[model samples]
Target: MFVRIVKMGFQPDKIDAFFENFEANKNQIRNFEGCLFLELYRDKNNTNQFFTYSYWEDEAALENYRKSDLFLKVWGETKVWFNQKPEAWSVDKVVSLE
Candidate 1:
């Protein structure tokens, strides 16, 4: 499987807005074709920082989603709330412990 991890830092005041948007759209993103799983995480000490971990069938699957209208809408609204540019990594699972 393909994995994607994205780190996002938002304006302190925009944290709640970002979370609300994620909650509203998580289902659609998870249900998108080739998506296997989706999850969100927040930093304990840095409340304004968040991370998204998702599993895709393959890199191409992820690329398709990135180019989709869903991404355009979500990212378009989301980028404005960022305090700094976001970061991301795409990788393959090396091993499984469970």
Candidate 2:
């Protein structure tokens, strides 16, 4: 499995718009092929900061999503709302309890 994490910092005023965009596409993204999980998280001390956590079957699945037209539209609009450059990581589990 492959996991992807993205840490995003949004312009304070544009946070709502960012949520709207995520709400609009979250389901579609989760339902995409090879996607096994999806989640969103907010920073404890920073309301405008958020992170997306998702699991894919493999790197190719994640890459396919990145190249999809939906991604193009969503990311294009989403990046404009950022107050700082977003950070992303793709990784595989090293160990698991269960």
Candidate 3:
């Protein structure tokens, strides 16, 4: 499995809107094909900062989702609330205890 982590910084005034949007769409995202797992996290020091951590079957699977209409809609709505450009990383797991 591979992991995709996205770091997002939202505008302070738009945080609530972003939260609601994520809550509303998270289920569909989690259920998308190739998605093995999904999680959302907030930065300890900055409430406006968040991260989406997800696991996919492989690169192709990730690409499929990235190209899907669902992504287009979700990302379209989400990007407008961003205080800065989002950053993402795709990587392979090297080791895990559990």
Candidate 4:
């Protein structure tokens, strides 16, 4: 499986709007092919910092989702709210305790 993580820093005032946009389109994103799981995480100490953690069947599957309209729509709107460029990483599972 491929594990993908994306960390985003949002402008304080734009946080609510960003979440609204995400809630509106999250289902469509989760329904994409080869998507095994999807979730959102926020830093307790820093509310404006959020992270998206997803599991995909493979890198190609993740890439396919990235190329889809669902991604474009969500990202296009989300980008405007960012205080800084987001960071993303993809990695293979080494081991899982659970």
User: Where's the lowest-lDDT run of ten residues in candidate 3?
Assistant: 89-98
Candidate 1's C-alpha runs over 4 A off are: none
lDDT of 2 at 43: 96
What tens digits encode model 1's per-residue C-alpha lDDT throughout 50-84? 99999999998999999999999999999999998
lDDT of 4 by residue, 32-78 (tens): 99999999999999989999999999999999999998898889999
What is the Cα-based lDDT of residue 35 in candidate 3? Answer: 98
Number of backbone-clashing residue pairs for each candidate, in the order shown = 0, 0, 0, 0
Q: Against the hidden true structure, what lDDT does model 1 obtain? A: 0.95
Candidate 2 yields a Cα-based lDDT of 0.94
**Candidate 2: minimum summed lDDT over ten consecutive residues — where?**
89-98
In angstroms, how far off is 56's CA in candidate 1?
Answer: 0.5
| Candidate 3 structure, TM-score to reference | 0.97
RMSD of each: 0.7, 1.0, 0.6, 0.8
State the lDDT at 5 in candidate 3.
Answer: 98
lDDT of 3 at 31: 94
Model 2: per-residue Cα lDDT over 1-98, one tens digit each: 98899999999999999999999999999999989999999999998899999999998898999999989999999999999999999988888797
Q: Please identify model 3 stretches exceeding 4 Å from their true place.
A: none
